[model samples]
Target: MNSFWAVFKRELKSYFTTPLAYVFLVIFLFFSGYLTFKEGFYEARQADLKPFFVNLPLLFVFMVPSTAMRLWAEERKVGSVELLFTLPITIVQAVLAKFFAAWLFLGIALALTFPLVVTVCYLGNPDIGLIVTGYLGAFLMAGGFLAIGCFFSALSKNQVIAFVLSVVACAVLVFAGMPTTLNYVSTFLPPGMVAAVEGMSFQVHFDSMQRGILQFQDLAYFVLLIAGWVAACAIVLDERKAS
Candidate 1:
């Protein structure tokens, strides 16, 4: 437990000790706000932050992977992974620590968008519950993206390759549930298979929560997605350590 905290703290603090983190944060905040406003936030004149939440999955597809691509790839590239493995922490502990650290960092990025929330509230009497659920859904979706990125990061020593693979994988998941994608696939695929694929997509579940309808299945989807990918990441690192 102590070793886990040590590693977790180290990983979290490392984000701020570099200039890249700040640069990434700046870019994320700017685009988040720009995309929200660009989505007719003012023109629509709605008190809700639908525009803000709507762009999260696409934004996270790029941003979260970039944040995660370095988690393990840099350690491997710099040969520090050997030293990391020598620590008292188990592989699973290390993986969880690193995942949590990155998840919290993403959460911080999400939290920094609070000004948008305030703006929505001031403009009109919006459904506070909807705003809360939207944030929750976005945060969970970010975790899912990060988990996939972590797995890809563990698979390669090159950060660029990891980032690219993560982005492709995340984009596929997001696009799979889009109505256009499903309609196109349904033209040839069996109905059951199409349903299965849509169920597996991040969009299907995220859209549910975006509307403040938090079903058990939607929540379970994200929990399982995060757990499954993080476990895969740990397995990959363990194998690499053994070899």
Candidate 2:
């Protein structure tokens, strides 16, 4: 537990010490706001933040990977992964610490968009429950994306390769459940297969939470997704250490 906090603090501090955190915050805030208004936030004449929540999955597909690409790839690239493994911390502990640190960084980034919430509140009355659930869903979705990125980052020494692989994987998860994608697949595929693909997607569950419906299965999906990838990341790093 002590080792976990030590590494977690070290990892979290590294973000602010570098330009990556600042640049990510700026770009993320700019693009998130731009995409929101561009989608007719005002023109829709609605007080809700639907435009913002609707665009998050697509934005996270690219942004979260960029944040995660350096997690293990940079360590491997500089041969510091060996040094990292030499620490007293176990592989699982190290993995969880780093994952939670990055997850918190993302939470901070997500929290910085509070002005959007304030704006919505100022505009008119909105469903507080829906807004709260939407943020919760977005945060969970970001964790899913980050976990995949962490696995790919551990799998590659090259950051670009990790980033590209993460982006592709995240995109598949997000796009697989889209209405158009499902419709197209169902044209030839059996209904069970199509349903299975849709169930495996990030969109179907996220959409439910975005609409303020937080089912146990939706929560379970994210918990399982995050745990599965983080476990994979630990396994990869453990093997590398063994070798």
Candidate 3:
């Protein structure tokens, strides 16, 4: 436990010291502001944050991989992964600590967008419940994507490859419930199987919660997704250590 906490704190603090964190944050804020302004013009809805939340999955699809790509890939590239392996912690503990650190970064990014909420409230009587739910959906999806990103990060020592792999995985998940994907799969699979795949999409379940409907299934899906991927990362790391 001590080792886990140590790793978590160290990783978290390392981000702020490096220029990477500041650069990414600046770019993220720029895009967030741009999207918000664009959404405002197109929707012409004063009190709704529909545009901001609508672009969340897209924003995270790229932002998250940037963070995760460096987690293991950079460490391995510079041969620091060996130093980490020499510690007292197990691979699972390290994986969880690293994952939580990345998730916390995303959480802070989401929190910094509070001005959007204030803007909506100042303009009209917007539903805070929906706003809360939208942020919740965004945060959960970020964690889930980070897990997926972490898996790719462990696959190689090349940060570029890691980033590209995570992006591809995220893209598939983001579009999992889209009509095109489902329609294509519907031709080859049974109706029930196709429906099940659609249900498994992050967007399908996220939409319900983003609209202020807190469903247990959506919550469980994210929890399970994160757990599954983190566990996979640990197993991979352990296998390499043993070999």
Residue 152, candidate 3: alpha-carbon lDDT: 86
For residues 1-243, could you state the per-residue lDDT of candidate 2 as single tens digits?
599999899999999999999999999999999999896999888888899999999999999999999999888888877887787878899889999999999999999999999999999998999999999999999999999999999998889999999999999999999999999999999999999999999999999999999999999999999999999999998877434
- lDDT against the true structure, per candidate, is 0.93, 0.94, 0.86
Per-model TM against the reference: 0.98, 0.98, 0.94
Query: For all the candidates, what are their Cα RMSDs to the real structure?
Result: 1.0, 1.1, 1.7
Greater lDDT among 2 and 3 belongs to: 2
* Ranked candidates (lDDT, high to low): 2, 1, 3
**Per-residue alpha-carbon lDDT of candidate 1 for residues 1-243, written as tens digits (9 for 90 to 100):** 598899899999999999867988999999999999985898898899899888989999999999999999999888888998897779999999999999999999999999999998889999999998999999999999999999999999889999999999999999999999999999999999999999999999999898999899999999999999999999999887534
User: After aligning candidate 1 to the native by TM-score, how far in Å is the CA of 143 from where it should be?
Assistant: 0.5
- Candidate 3 runs further than 4 Å off: 40-42, 241-243
As a whole number from 0 to 100, the lDDT of residue 183 in candidate 1 is 98
